[model samples]
Target chain A: MILAIASGKGGTGKTTVSVNLARAFDSEIQLLDCDVEEPNDHLFLKGAPTGREIIGIPVPEVDEALCDGCGECGRFCEYHAIVSFGTTPLVFPEMCHGCGGCTMVCPVKAIRETAKPIGAVETRRAGNVTLVQGRLDIGAAMAPPLIHAVKARLRRDLPAILDAPPGTSCPVIATLRGADFVLLVTEPTPFGLHDLTLAVEMVRALGIPFGVVVNRVGLGDDRVHRYCGQRHIPILLEIPDDRRIAEACSRGGLIVEALPEYRGLFRNLVGKTMFRTNPKEA
Target chain B: MKVAFTVSGGDLAAPLDSRFGRAPKFLVYDLDKETFEVVDNRQSLDAAQGAGIQSAETVARLGAKALVTGHCGPKAFRVLRAAGIGIHYAGEGTVAEALARYRAGELPEAAAPDVEGHWA
Candidate 1:
C-alpha cells in the first residue's frame, strides 16, 4: 500500500514525520520525495544516490524550410507558447507544456518533437529504506512533470511512503495521486488549521481516505483538534513540542536514531496507520 | 505609413493606455488616407500568459509601421522590432495628442524595451 504524507501549510513537520515513520518501520519500505522544487528528505536521510537519471518533456520544434507558414501549430497550442503572424512561428520554450498538440495540428508536418531537460531523479539507499527524490533544474517551471518522474520510481513489491510538497497545487496533487492512504500532517496553529481545512476539502474531493497527524502539539491553541473532532477526522498521532526533537532535526539527525525513546511512538504510529488501511493483515 | 496607439477607448481623444499588453483598445491610423480604425484588444487583456506576444502578433498582422504606448516589454519589443515596427513612448496624454507629438518628431524612438516582461 502507498501512503502519502502531505501538509497544505509550509513547515509543519512533513519531512520529519516522513523520515521518522520510514525509520520506525521494522521491515523494508520505500520513500519517494515528490517535492521536486525543494527536496529535503536526503538531508536527514544521508545516503549516496545509487542511481540518477535525467527527466524531461518533449517540446515542439518547428522547421522553417518545410513549407508555408499556415499558423496552424500556433493556433493549436493552448499555452500560447508558439504564435505566428502569417510568418514563421516564434516558440517560447519556457511556456511550452510539452503536450505535443502543436505537432499533431500542423498541416505541413513541419513541427517535430524535441527533448527539453526539466529535472533529474535520484535513487538512494539508507538501511532498510530506499529514498527516491526529484531535483528540478533551476528556472524550470514544470514541477508536476518532475513529480511524476519521482513517483515512477515506486516499487510495487514494498510498501511506499510518499512525501508530498506543501500546498494544494499541481505538484502536491501529482504526489497524492494513486495513494492508498494519505497522512495529513499539520501543527495546531491558526495557519495550520486554515490550510488543513483546505487540504481536507481537497482530499475529500479526490475521494481519498485521510487522517491527521498533529505535530508540535503544545505550541498552538486547541483549534485544530476541535475542528478535527467536529469533522470526525481521526487524529492518528501527535508529536510533542520538544526542544530535543528540534535540536536533533537541526543537526540533520533522524529522531528514531537520535532519540530512541521516540522510536516507540513512531513505531506505534506505523502500527495504527497500517491497521486502519488493511484490517485483515493487521 | 500606418501607426498604432494603445488606447483606453475607440476614439483618438481617449486616454492613452499605460500598458502595452493589457491595453483595452488599439487605434491604427493611416497617415496617407487620414483614416483610423479601432482594434479591440480585450482578448489579450485576459490572456493567462504571453499577453504581450499576442498583442504584438495583432499589431504585426495589422501592418502597423510604428507603435506608441506608455511602456513596452521585452517580448513585445522583440516581436515588434522583428516585424520592422518602431516603438515610441508617450507620457500621460490622449491618443490624439500622442499622435500629434509623433508627427512633430518630438517623441524619441525607444532603443530597447523600456520595461521588463509582464510589467503591467
Candidate 2:
C-alpha cells in the first residue's frame, strides 16, 4: 500500500509521523520524503545517502544571433514567461513551466531547450526502510518537478510511504496524487482545524481515501474531533502533547526510538491505515 | 469593467449559467457587452492542477478586468493581481449567480486564497 503522510500546516509532525511509521513496519519499506524544499527525515534517520541524482527542468534559451525577434516564440508561449514585441525576446526562467511550447513555436528556431538544475534527489537505506528524498536547489522556486523525480524511485514491491510537504498546494498534490491512501496529520488547535477542513475538501475533491491522525491531541480543543465526527471521517490515531517526544524530535531522534512504547502506536496506526484502505485486509 | 469568471463546461446553459450554484471550468465574461465566453481549458497544454495561474494569465491577457472562481492560490492570485485583474472567491456556484453577486456587490473583494497547497 502507498501511504502519503501530509498536514495542512507546517511543523505539524508530518515528518515525525512519516519516519516513525516507516520504522514501525516489519517488512522492507520505502520512505520517500517528497518535501523537497526542506527535507528533515534524514536528520532523524541519520543514514548516509547511498545515491544522488540531479533533477533538471527545461527552460527556453534564446539564441539572439540566430534571427530577429519575430515575437513568434513569445506569442506561442502560453505562460508569458517569454515576452518579445519590438526587441529581443526576454525569457523569465522562474515563470517558465518548461512546456517547450516556445521551442516548437519559434519560427526561426532561435529558441533552444536547456536543462536548468532545479534540485537533487538522494537515496538512503535504514535497515529495511529505504529513504528517498529530494532537495530543491536553494534558489529554485518550483518543487513539483523535483518531487516527481523523488517519486520516480518508488519500489513497487515494497509498501511505500510518501512524506508529503505541508499544506494543500501544488507540490502537496503532486506528491500525494497517485498514493492509494493519504494520512492527514494535524494538531487539535484552531489553526489545525481550519486547515484540516481545507485539506478534507481537497482530498474529497481528488476522490482519494483518507483519514486523520491528531498529533498533540490533548493540547488543543475538540473542534477537530467534532468536525471529523460530523463528516464520518475516522480519527485514526492520537499522540498526546508529550514533552519527551518533542525533545527527542528536536534532537533528531525518532519517536519510536525515544519512547519505544510509541512503536506500537505507529504500528496500530499503520494497521488502521491498511484496514481503512482495504477493509478485507483487516 | 470587463470581468472573467472561470466556468467548467463550455457555453452557458441554467444550473450551469451561474457561478454560485456550480464552479465554472473557467469563464471570461465581458462586463460591458454583458456577454460571457467560455475559456477552453480542456487542452493539456494549459491545464495547471492548482489555481491554474497560467490559465488565469491567459484570461487576463484576453482583456479581462476581474476573475470569478471557486478558489485560487497565492501564485495565481499574485499573477492576476499584477495583471490588474480583480479576483472573487466564490465557492461552487453557478456562473450566473457569481456574476450576479458581483453585479449586486454582494461578493467579497477577491483576496489571495489561503496559501495552502493543492490538497488544502
Candidate 3:
C-alpha cells in the first residue's frame, strides 16, 4: 500500500512521521520525498546516491520565420505564458505548464516543444529502504512537475511512503494523488488545527481515506483531538512533546533508531494505517 | 506619441496607480491628438500570475510609445522594452499630470526594472 504523510502547516513534523514510519517496518519499503522545494528526508535516511535523473517539462518555443502572428497561441494559454500583440508571440518559459495546448492551437504551426529543466530526482539506498527525493532548481516555480517525476519512480511491488510538502496547494495535491492512504500529521495548536481543517477538506475532496497523526501532542490544547473526534476522523497515533525527539531530529537522526522504546509506536502505526486502508488485510 | 499611464479611475483625472502590473486601468494619452482614452485593466488585476506580461501586451497593442507608472517589474520591463515602449517613472499625481510631466521631460526614463517581479 502507498501511504502519504502530509501536513497543512510547515514544521508540523510530516517528515518526522514519514521517516520514522518507514524505519518501523522491518521489511523493505520505498520512501518518496515529494517536497521538491525543500526535501529533507534524505538528511535523516542517508545512503549513497544510486541514480539521478534531471526532470524537465515541455515549454513552447515559437519560430519567427514560419509564424503568421495569428495571436492564437496567446489566446490558448491560460497562464499568460505566451502573449502576442499582432506580431510574433513571446514565450515565457517559467509560466508555461507544458500543456502543449498552444502548439496544438497554432494555425501556422510556429510553436514547437522544448525541454526546460526544472529539477532533478535522485535515488538512494538507505538500508532496507529505497529513498527517492526530488530537488527543484533555485528560483524554479514549478514544483508539481518535479513532484510527479519523483512519484513516477515508485516501485509498485514494494510498499511506498510519500512525504508530502506542507499546505493544501498544488504541490501537496500532487504528492497526495494516487496514494492508498494518507497520514495527516499536525500539532495541537490553533494554527495546526486551522490548517488541518483545510487539509482534511482537501483529502475529503479527493475522496481518499486518511487518518490523523497528532505530533507533539502536549505542545498545545486538545482542539485537534476534539476536532477530529467530532468529525469521526481516526487518530492513528500521537507523539508527545518530547525534547529527545526534537534533538534526534535536529541531528538528522531517526526517532526509531535513537529512541528504541518509541519504535513500537511507529510499528503499530504501520499496522493501524494498513488496516485503515484495508480492513480485511490487517 | 501615445503614452500609457497606470491609473486607478475611469478618466485622465484618476490617481496614478503605484503598481503597474496589477493596476486597475490604463489611461492612453495621445500627445499628438491631445486626447485620451481609458482602458480597463481588471483582467490583469485579477490574474493569479504573469499580470505584468499581460499588461505589457495590452499597452503595446494599444500603440503606447511609453508607460508611466510608479514602479515596473522585470518581466513587464522586458516585454515593454521588446515592444519598443519605454517605461517612465511618475507617481503621486493624476494621470493628466503624469502625462504633462512626460511631455515636459520631467519624468525620468527607467533604465531597468525598479523592483523585482510580484512587487505590490
Clashing pairs in 3: none
Candidate 2: regions farther than 4 A off: A275-282, B1-120
Number of the candidate with higher DockQ, 2 or 3:
3
lDDT of 1 by residue, A1-282 (tens): 888999889899899999999988988999999889999999998877799999998888889898377888877877778877667887888788888898888888989989999999999999888999999999998899899888888889889999999999889999998988888999999999999999999888777888999999999899999999988898888999999999999999999999998898899889877546452221
Best by DockQ: 3
DockQ for each numbered candidate: 0.46, 0.05, 0.64
TM-score of every candidate relative to the true structure: 0.89, 0.69, 0.95
Sort order, lDDT high to low = 3, 1, 2
Candidate 3, residues A53-140, lDDT tens digits: the string is 9999999999999988888998889898888766787888999988999999998889999999999999999888899999999999
lDDT of every predicted structure (CA atoms): 0.89, 0.78, 0.90
Best by lDDT: 3
For model 2, state the Cα shift of residue B39 in Å. 23
Candidate 2 lDDT over B1-120, as tens digits, reads: 677766556654433322221233556677777786665554423345323455554666678877766666655665566667777776656667777888998877765565443433
Off by over 4 Å in 1: A278-282, B1-3, B7-17, B22-47, B58-65, B82-84
Interface RMSD of 3: 1.3
Cα RMSDs, all models: 3.0, 10.8, 2.1
